[model samples]
Target: MEELWGRRVLLTKQFSAVLDAYQTFPAMIDQGAYMRCTRCNTELLKTAILLPSGFYYCPSCIQMGRIDSSLQLIHQAEPANQTREVFLDWQGTLTPAQEEISIALCHSLAQKKPHLIHAVTGAGKTEILFEAIYRALKKGGRVALASPRVDVCLELYPRLQEVFPKETIALLYGGNEQKYTYTSLVICTTHQLLHFYHAFDFLIVDEVDSFPFQGDKKLAYAVSQATKEDSCLTYLTATPPQALLKEIQASFIISQLPARFHRRPLPEPEFIWWNHWAAHSKKGTHLGKLYQLIDQLSQKNHVLLFCPSIHLMDCLFQHVQKHFPDLQVEKVHADDDQRKEKVTKMRQHHYQLFLCTTILERGVTFENVSVIILGANHPVFTKATLVQISGRVDRKGAYNFGRVCFLYDEQTVAMKLALKEIKLNNQLARKRGLVDEL
Candidate 1:
């Protein structure tokens, strides 16, 4: 009981003995029982399999560690009240737009209202949350910062740790080995929130437009279950969906930052028509234009070549290496074992050419990098993804301008929409004097 204080634990049939030893409650319905999940309110159905021991298991959240019948979830009832002297160590200053939104966000969190910060990429959205998070921690309130991608969590953990060094900050993921502790700050993937129960006083969902969390009802339910009833929730995203926008228009507190932290407009994507380029590339014919583009760009800038699929990325990587033997090139995807190491190497300027899929589209930044979206017409490349990929360029203050080229066999609605959105944001930024002179 002492060890379980201020922690939520998911038990299974295998832990029946432990349930008997401690105060326990059913985490899910028994097999064949007409009961809904107390947390997500998901009804038991055929998917809930009956085990050999006459118990039912929820298959809905099996990916988040299984929750079976006869298993009891044990949660410490009392608030942890584990407060500490939390201080912001970050020395950077937020832009005026960011400062205004940051103050409103802190007030909204105090009032337990839902808010959304619609900021473009490289807008210093993370820094804006420091004030709100600091206030939450200082008041003995637990806070959780969640994102759909583990890469986002990996990037945010160290930064948040540096900002609130005295607070216990826990980073949770699928295979994390860290034991659950009474921590004031928790940074984790959105999927990991399924394991939490009414735990946080404040919840911030970053990259709300990204995958696994964007349209996932289960993940959304998990987020609701994880936070307290009165806990404030803040969403941050560059491209918000229609539903979220409607919510913002109806009631949610809304804030917008169209310009980046460097006060530069987003790099508009240039459309390059290459008819049947994929077939020609596979045939090793009509390679002059691509080679010329690479040759010209590789002279001074790092190139991120976005392929539609992993197989295509590999094929393109081989062809590029064969053609440009002197150039440093590498391919990465979701399954790459050395993805972190490769990204580090890329940041260290070890590789001039990075060929990848949408996996490198968001939550990653490189200075003086130009983007090439091969097969931009592919159905997989959505408008939001293209915007994010284009936003990757011109991120650093030292080099706040770069090229974004979309190589497509045919013009796609998504591609056109992406370009138009970027232009509109830049126009708005300039009109508001949020951007520097073009």
Candidate 2:
């Protein structure tokens, strides 16, 4: 339009639309007034040149140098429509076998189908995401790849950046910023979706059944509202939830890869009850079986002892450190600011013994990890948590000698279910020849 007040001005539908939105918002910045393009929710930068017609046009999308202030383009240009094939490393780069399955999964997701690939931990699930994302990007669409933990996103982002160098893929987390111009692909924590509204063309939810994301309907609704109704939604996880199973129809696609890189079997976890024995000593306690494991591993390598709480972790740390004074013992948890540095120290072998809560149970990979779950019988241990904890060891190679000790006072329901679930996964992997004869 020629004038903001009134005018015998001519305007195209798009400029009229941009103008319509601009009028509704007050010029005051702190008045809680901001204008976002309804189509993309793209906020016009305040530095943008305001036309006489009072339309704020992003130079990136539209340009009006002079003459009519109605955004009659000096030289009309199309919105960015460049789409390039990109790879996404969900785990890392893929091998020939992994590449095959990745290709299949990509096709399935692009077709708006549901498929399950029960790949083991360290099966390179992150690298496998590349093909799927590439297919969607080449189809001229935006993709949302989300995970329940910021830990997973931290690992998933850099690899995606390497594969999709041309596409803008911003990593979104609670404390992170949106630093890209217009992201065609996004790696984000599930919580970050709360601020989105119809912002993507494809949505991929990783670790779908893991924690916080599964329980929050607002996050789920955020995913739904952040995409067009016809957008493809891809779900990835080692284990599936009851709700996901119920949502399945024939249109869903399923794939399975049950082996690690070296093809060694998933570890066998043993249960030992030292409750009766340890209970006899009111001073402190030790499960003979777990103690034996600690002694054996300490002779050769470091050990990761996981407990249910901070108090339990400290108690174990003290108890273990007393007997092995020559050894270094360190711990990490939510309350510690040195948590990351502690983990780094452990990785560098600064300490031969480490006690940790569930925080270190993921994202970080250890080559020679021997996991011992104290109080495995406690109700705090769930199938998913146990599975994640167990995933820490023997990332590659033959049957790892590390022992997984589930030492408990009693075998609670959580213990039984976690054991059963792990064994079931092993059996599934074994059938696929994912494990050695052992």
Candidate 3:
């Protein structure tokens, strides 16, 4: 029955073990001409959705499970658990800038106001969030930190576990094998929030600009529905999207952390002309420049080679393996079955060169890494994405500098914009005296 708390699930025989314990509600609400999905709130015309069996189903959330007119959704009101007297176990200290943002976050939570933290890539956003999270938990309030990317959630879970070791934190995401547990703290992807309704008193959306949360209406709806009426909602992003900016203009309290905790300048990308590189890569010929760059960078730092597409990345990965057999290199994309293991291997310095798609552009960090994009002009490489990919380098305080190269046939607007943004951030850090002279 604890597993049923705060969750809205379809009334299936699988849940018969707890079905009698909670009241059930209709899965779809009918309005004369249309029916709305109780989970996703997607509306469909009754005439367009009528089934031969006289049952209307919500196709919008069918991936979760078929919620048809015949089914019911059951949930238990979120209960305030008896929290430990002290939950935070971290011994690290926040920088002055981070401490200021942390205070602002706590104030927002106390006021139950929506807030946004527009911080730079390595600005210690998580550290800034700790105080607020602790305050909420101390009050026995349910808290959830959601992101759009599964990689981000995976990266954040262990860190949260380390900081709040005494608390039972549930990590939820699609394809996750971990069984659900009722707890005060939850780290999950935005999609998982669809299973919850008014569950959180303190909710945060990290990497708010990253897809599929960005420009995703259903995900936004889920975030809204998951929070209690008087709950505090916070958004954290290095790159602020137009939607967030507009919200700040309207009412949200905004905190801007322009410099990283390391107090170092952001690395600007160096554009190198590699004409006809794609054809050469596909044919496995005339890659001397690319080979030379990888060889030199790999000598001192790990190499992150970003390809524009999976097909191209796979082709290049084979070529790289053939050319540098002794160098431990691995390729990962969205659908790689061994993605998690491969990334872990890279983190342990087992892999010298990692070839990947933009799936790794944000949320994960690597120290002393040099970034090289195969096709900087590709449509898929947006300015925000390029910034995030470049940010993966030199993230730790020990390694405060690294290289970023944009290898392209022709530079695109996105490439130019990414460079401009990095430079602008550096200038801001200098103006604010947040970084020392190099």
Best prediction by lDDT? 3
- The residue-by-residue lDDT of candidate 3 on 62-151, one tens digit each, is 767678888889888777546557568889999888998899999999999999999989888998999999999998789999999998
Tens-digit lDDT track of model 2 for 234-318: 7777767667766664556666666776667667678866765334222356445556777887775578888788876766666
Q: Give the range of the ten consecutive residues with the poorest summed lDDT in model 1.
A: 30-39
Q: Rank the candidates by TM-score, best first.
A: 3, 1, 2
Instruction: Please report how far candidate 1 places residue 280 from its true position, in Å.
Output: 2.9
Name the regions of candidate 1 deviating beyond 4 angstroms. Answer: 1-7, 12-23, 30-41, 78-83
- Per candidate, the number of residue pairs that clash is 0, 16, 0
Name model 2 segments beyond 4 Å from true.
Answer: 1-81, 85-97, 114-116, 165-168, 177-181, 249-251, 276-291, 347-349, 397-400
Checking candidate 1 for backbone clashes, the offending pairs are none
**Local accuracy by lDDT, each model:** 0.82, 0.64, 0.88
1-438 per-residue lDDT for model 1 (tens digits): 443544456654544655645556677754454545544446777444667886667766777666666666776543655666777798889888889999999999879999999989888899999999998888888899999988788878888888877767889887777876666788999987876777788999999889989988878988887878888988999999888798567667999999998887888999988888888666777878888888877776899999898877777788899999998999899889898889878878799899988988888878888888988999989999999999889887576346898998899899999999999999999998999976
